[model samples]
Target chain A: MLRDITIGQYFPGQSPIHKMDPRMKIIATLLYIVMLFVASHPLSLIVGIAMLVLMYRVSGIPMKMITKSLKPVVPIIIFTSVLNIFFVSGDPLFQFGFIEITRQGLMLAILMSVRILCLIAGSSLLTYTTSPIELTDAIEILLNPLKKVKVPVHELSMMMTIALRFIPTLIEETDKIMNAQKARGADMESGGLMQRAKALVPILVPLFVSSFRRADELAMAMECRCYRGGDGRTRMKQLHYSHRDWIALCIMLVSIAAVLLLNRILA
Target chain B: MAVIKTENLSHVYSEGTPFVKTAIDNISIEIEEGQMIGVIGHTGSGKSTLIQHFNGLLQPTSGKIYIDGEDMWADKSKLRDIRFKVGLVFQYPEYQLFEETCYKDIAFGPKNMGLDEGEIDRRVREAAAFVSLSEEQLMKSPFELSGGQKRRVAIAGVLAMKPKVLILDEPTAGLDPKGRDRILGQIKEYHQEEKNTVLIVSHSMEDVAKFAQKVLVMNRSKVFLYDSVENVFARAGELSQIGLAVPQITQVFMELKKRGYPVNSNVYTIEAAKKEMIRLLEKGGEVRA
Candidate 1:
């Protein structure tokens, strides 16, 4: 059941997005997020959605995957949208007993929902296309300048990479521990909240113990290989910005400029 | 009545994903009561998957599982009770030890069954005794024990539940020869005293040959053979074809028979091979007077 988590999971493929430089993908995702918030007009939102649709098609990730990523955030979307509709004051559109949905409030709610959906889908696309190793390497390279200020950029990135690498391993361990406990008749399901939480003791204790053992062994293995920080470390697969990255950057700039221009003219 | 039965049981992992795999396929078998069955197969031959279904740790993608003639999934709420009825000690079970003391660790299962304090204590002590865990060792934290002792504690945890059917997956894996024999010996003793069904999934054919009354061979996610140990090991050729070999003693006897010696090639254990060797010598008219 834990395997169903689709968020932050890499989807291996040879699609253009998958082949794009990880650094470029990261920049593109951030720019897209910024553009979504900056755009005020519906026409700009349409343009943003259109670009997203085209990117999704080209990435070759199935529609089902994007929908799966969206499933978990449904509650958040509804909660925020409802709050916006009732809390934002404007021309009254629907009113009932000290509760009202205003014209501006309804419009804001719709926009917020769309923005939230697009934000998740766009970011999820980046993760789906970029492998975790490449993502971490790109972050380290991009943040290299922070080292001038005595920031431990390399160490932080190394930590991130190791943590990301161990997610699946830890997940497998948890699955094994859960099954072992369940075989002992641990009732994880069915029970009051407290009872259910109490049932997790058998699973959690074992998992934590195994995790510590794994961490200790991993550290020893790393030390045996003479790994000492990231000083003078060289990557086997070096990052290169190809012509496609330039084209992608140009498209992103043009879209943001167009969105801003249209918003100003329409306003 | 068969203590455990599966009707065309099949398990396909990650079913709807691109990584879909059929771990077990169309396996139908009825394990009789009071039988010690050894499950043997190459890695990924579905040996682990099959035993997991018996205890409801895994639900078959397609098929029915019955624990003592009652459909396991017929009532979802009773699955926990079913799990207690079919105890499973997973591979590297010692890693599941988490209690402050070995006694509490063994008591975890019985406590989960909602047994009274006295009953839980009694079962814990009995299970510990079955595994030969000393009173002092029981008070020590399970984390403080050696790998073999931790393994015994984990197995004791399941035994304390007093399940009708006990299934152990590679219980002796990664243990020294002495540790292996000790654990398997205790399991054999427990089976004899309780007369409960025991299924031991093992890679070592010798261990199974010495203890199992019956053998179940799996090949490519299907039951290759399920019969008496003699019958299963008799087809040494077919067994080897699937990357599994009969006990070494059985192989030696087969070679002896092939060398034109008037020897029965059916011996699978060391003791049986010794008896066969003495019988062959007596038949040769070489008796020392």
Candidate 2:
């Protein structure tokens, strides 16, 4: 049942996007996100969507996987669209007493839904292409300048990496504890709200106990490795931008320009 | 008659995910009544996954699991009834104990079955006695007991259900030598007294060899071998290949058998090996444990 929760599952590949320096990839992902709201017209949103699809393909990750990753967000996507359809104001194209459906409201709802979909799908491409290890490395590099302002960048990134690593381990432990409780005749499924909440105590207690044990072991292991922040520690895989990275950046810049130009022309 | 049987059973995980796996694939095994079955496999070899299916804790992704020759999942409404008949004591039994008092915790399963107060009390006391827990221990908080005592209380919780086929996933794990022996001895005695099917899922070759009449070896989610203890130990070398082995005494006797001695290679216990060696040496100078 927990197999549905997909986080930090690296898609194995050797595509150009995957090969791009993690730093460039991080920047590109941010810039791509910025471009999502750069235009209001349907034509420009189409361009943004097409760009995301192109990036998704270049990431060498399967389209099916991208949708699979979006599954947990499906309810949220539907919720937001429903909310916007009701609240977004314009001339009422269809009126029924207290309810009104307008042309602009309907179009805005569609575009907003697509925007949310593309935003999730596009960024998931970044995570799909770059492993969590590389993503944290890129974050540390980007945050290095803030170290002058006393922002414990290394410690923050280290914490992020550790959390990322333990996500699956914790989930597995949860599954084990859940099954153990299930064996004890703990009725988890058929119950009222209070009964269901009470049933989870057996699972949660064990999970919490094991998680602390694992954390204690991990801290000791890290201390054994002489890990005291990112001080003078070099990484095995260095981040370096190539000519192709520069070309990719320029292409993204051109796309933003096209969206802006289209926005102005349409306005 | 077999208490539990699987017909071409399989469990495929993460069906469409990139990291999909088939934990138990096309496994068909019959577990007869009153037999101590030792299912051994390395970690992640579907040992846990396979056992969870015994009581319908897991619905098979494919095929069927029959409990007492009845389809376990045929009536989804009464699957919990199947659990009462196939008691699964998980690896860390202590984690399942949540009631304020040990008595209430032990009574949980029988209570879930809607048994009467008299029946629950009788089952709880009998199960507690089987685990060598005293009457005083039942009233105390289970969380207050020593780890071994806590483990015993958790185990009795399942035993109170009086399952026809008791499945323990590493019942003696984390116990000291004495604790391990005491617990296993109790389980064996329970099996003798009740004549119920006992399946102990463990990685310890010694424990299985010392007790179980049958051995079921699993490697990479598939049945590597399954047979009577003596028949399986005769192929000790193949067992070692999959990170398993015959009992130490059997290993030595098998070696002696290889060296043209009259030692019995099927001897799985030190006492049996010692007796065989004594008889063989009296006949000639022959065997040893």
Per-residue lDDT of model 1, residues A39-77, tens digit only? 896667876898889899999988788788899899999
Q: Candidate 1: misplaced stretches above 4 Å? A: A96-98, B283-289
How do the candidates score on chain B by TM-score?
A: 0.97, 0.96
Error of 2 at A89 (Å): 4.1
Clashing pairs in 2: none
lDDT of 1 by residue, B1-289 (tens): 8888899999999876677899999999999999999999999999998998888878889999988799999998889889898899999999999889999899989988999999999999999999999999999999999999999999999999998889999999999999999999999999999999999999999999999999999999999999999999899999898899999988998987787677788898889888987787877664332
Model 2, A1-267: lDDT tens per residue? 775776557786889988988898888888887887887876788778889778877776777876777787889888988877888888888888999888777877887777787788878888888899999999999989999999999999999999999998888878776776666667889779999888787777767766787899999998999988788898898888899899889988998889899888877
Docking model 1 quality class: medium
DockQ of model 2 vs. true complex: 0.52
DockQ in order: 0.76, 0.52
TM-score of chain A of 1: 0.97
